[model samples]
Target: MRLIIISGLSGSGKSVALNTLEDTGFDCIDNLPVDLLGAFGRHITELGEDAANQRYAVGIDARNQPEALARFPSILDGLRELGIHCEIVFLDADDQTLLTRFSETRRRHPLSDRDTSLSEAIQRERLLLEPLHERADLTVDTTRTTVHQLRDLVRERMVRAPFELSLSFESFGYKHGLPPDADFVFDARCLPNPHWEPELRQLTGRDEPVQAYLDQQPAIAEYFEQVRTFLANWIPSFQRENRSYLTVAIGCTGGQHRSVYLAERLGEHFRAERGPISIRHRELV
Candidate 1:
């Protein structure tokens, strides 16, 4: 049986991840206590080749008792010894983003009360979930991701063939913040600035004018080739290490032109060479 544990901070889209997994045919349980992990694994093992119950996903979080959460590693060891395939997918977002999400939704923090502020609750939750975070096989940072984007990402990753290293090329702006999930980040600000051109100012890298402008720049070409070469040389190493996901982020001043163009270019270049590729332009989305 295959088991995926979904654990993360509140407001970081754990629910969305779990739902996406369910939509993709995983039998999902939410807010499962950490202490029950072993029992759950054993129970699934006892199910014995029930095709409908072969894949399982459970959501675990800070709501569990601290002592129980601390026993996760040992429980996971026992589960693996039972020949169950286990993977942990941890989701996180920045403190400011979490605060904004809570404010926008008018929802109280899970760990907050009259004595604790929301920020404090977030910090406390972070500390409580550090062990799970440390053991995560995949970590997704959703500070700039919309609900739909998060859903799509979770769905795509969950449905990949076994042992495939899925690749994501994301574009962002330095003005916003770095994508916390990126394994590699490249800066495109030094390239030609299309935001300066009056006609091109309103257009994005996906637009022909912007693409043409960036295409003519010698520096951009060199940068793309070098980055591509670097990835080509190193990606095999990650695949050999059995990595399941890899994210490459490119950032410019505003995530409008250069970064988007480069990310798209990289995605197109790698699509033929790689198994599954996802290209996201953060500001555009």
Candidate 2:
């Protein structure tokens, strides 16, 4: 059986992720207590061969007792011993982002009460959930992610072929801060600036004019080739290690042009020789 444990901060889109998984045919349970995780796994195991092919996902959070939360690692080990393919997906966002979300929705934080302020509760929750965060197979930062984007990402990462790896290339602007979930980040800021040319200033890397402009730069070709070759050599190592996803981020002064171009180029080159490949332009979104 395939079991996924989703745990994260309250406003980090864990509900969206669980709903997406449920929509994709997973048997999802929300707010499952940590202490019952082992029993749940065993119960599923006893369901026999018919249940072996089923997919299960559960949400775990800081609402459980601190002692029980600390025992999560052992409980997870016991479940794996029962022959379950278990994976944890942890989501988080910066404090300011979480605070903004809570403020916008006018919702109370789960750990907050009359005695505790929202900021204090957020930090407390983070401390309480640190054990699970440490053991998570994937850590997703949703600071700049939208609800729709989060859903698509969850579906792409968890609903795909179990044995295949999903690769993604993301383009962002340095001024907007780095992508929190990127496994590898490359800087394209040193490349020639198309923004200086009035004709190409208004166009993006996806546009033919900007593409033509960038295609003429020798440095761009060299950078693309080097990055492509490096990933080509290392991708197999990750596959052998049974990694489910790999994110490569490229950044420039502004994400509209250079970074987007390299990301698209890399995605195109690798799509022909890989499993599942996705390209994301963060700023353009």
Candidate 3:
């Protein structure tokens, strides 16, 4: 059976992910008690091939007992031993984002009470969910994402074929901080800066003029070739190890220039050889 365990902070779009999976025909159950996960899998296992072929998505949150949440890793191991294909997708957002979301929605956090403030509840939830977060096959940061965008991301990244490795190339500005989910981070600030030109400053790496300017730089060419070569050599090793998702983050002084150019180029280069590839610019959108 293919089982996807969705878990994250209370306001981090976990429900959006589960709803998207359900729309894609997954048999989804939300807020399932952690202790019943093993029994549920065994019950489905005895249901035979038809049941096994049906995709399953379950939502797990910090509402469960602390002891049960702590045993998540072992429970996953047990599921794998039972011949089930299980994967975890952990959704997260920055503390400010979570706080804003809760304030806007006026929804009490699952772990929040009269004694606990929303900020404290958010921090405590993160600590409780650390085990699952560490073992996640994919971690999505929705700090700046809209609900519609989150739904599309879940559909593109999770609802596709099983066992196929999905690769994402993200571009970000050093000013905005690194993407917390990136597996490999490459620095492109050493390359020529397109932001210096007044005309190109208003444009992005996706613009033809900006692309042409970056392409003309000898240093840019060398940097792109080296980064591409390194990833080309190492990506397959990760695939061979059964890694289902990989995020390669490229950063520059500002995400609009060199980093975006390199991420676009790399995504194009690998999309031909790799089956599923996605590109995102953190500062632009």
Best by lDDT: 2
Instruction: Residues 1-285, candidate 2: write the lDDT tens digits.
Output: 789999999999999999999999999999999989999999999999988889999999989999999999999999989998888899999999999999999999999999999999999999999999988877888887899998988876788766477788999999999987788999999999899999989889999999998999999999999999899999899989878678899999989999999999999888887746788888886
Cα lDDT listed for each candidate:
0.90, 0.91, 0.90
Runs of candidate 2 exceeding 4 Å displacement: none
What would the TM-score be for candidate 3 when compared with the true structure?
0.97
Local lDDT at 278 for model 3? 85
lDDT of 3 by residue, 1-285 (tens): 689999999999999999999999999999999999999889888889778678999999999999999998889899999988898999999999999999999998988899999999999999999989989999999997899889978876787666777889999999899998899999888888988999999999999999999889999988889989999999889878877788999999978989999999999999888766888888886
lDDT of 1 by residue, 1-285 (tens): 678899999999999999998988889999999888899888878777783237789999999998988888998899889878788899999999999999999999999999999999999999999999988888888887899999998876766756678889999999988887789999999998999999999999999999999889999999999999999999999989878778899999999999999999999999988756889888995
**Per-residue lDDT value at 166 in model 1:** 80
Q: If ranked by TM-score, best first, what sequence of candidates would result? A: 3, 2, 1
Winning model by TM-score: 3
Which clashing pairs does model 1 show?
A: none
Whole-model alpha-carbon lDDT for candidate 1: 0.90
TM-score, structure 1 vs. true: 0.91
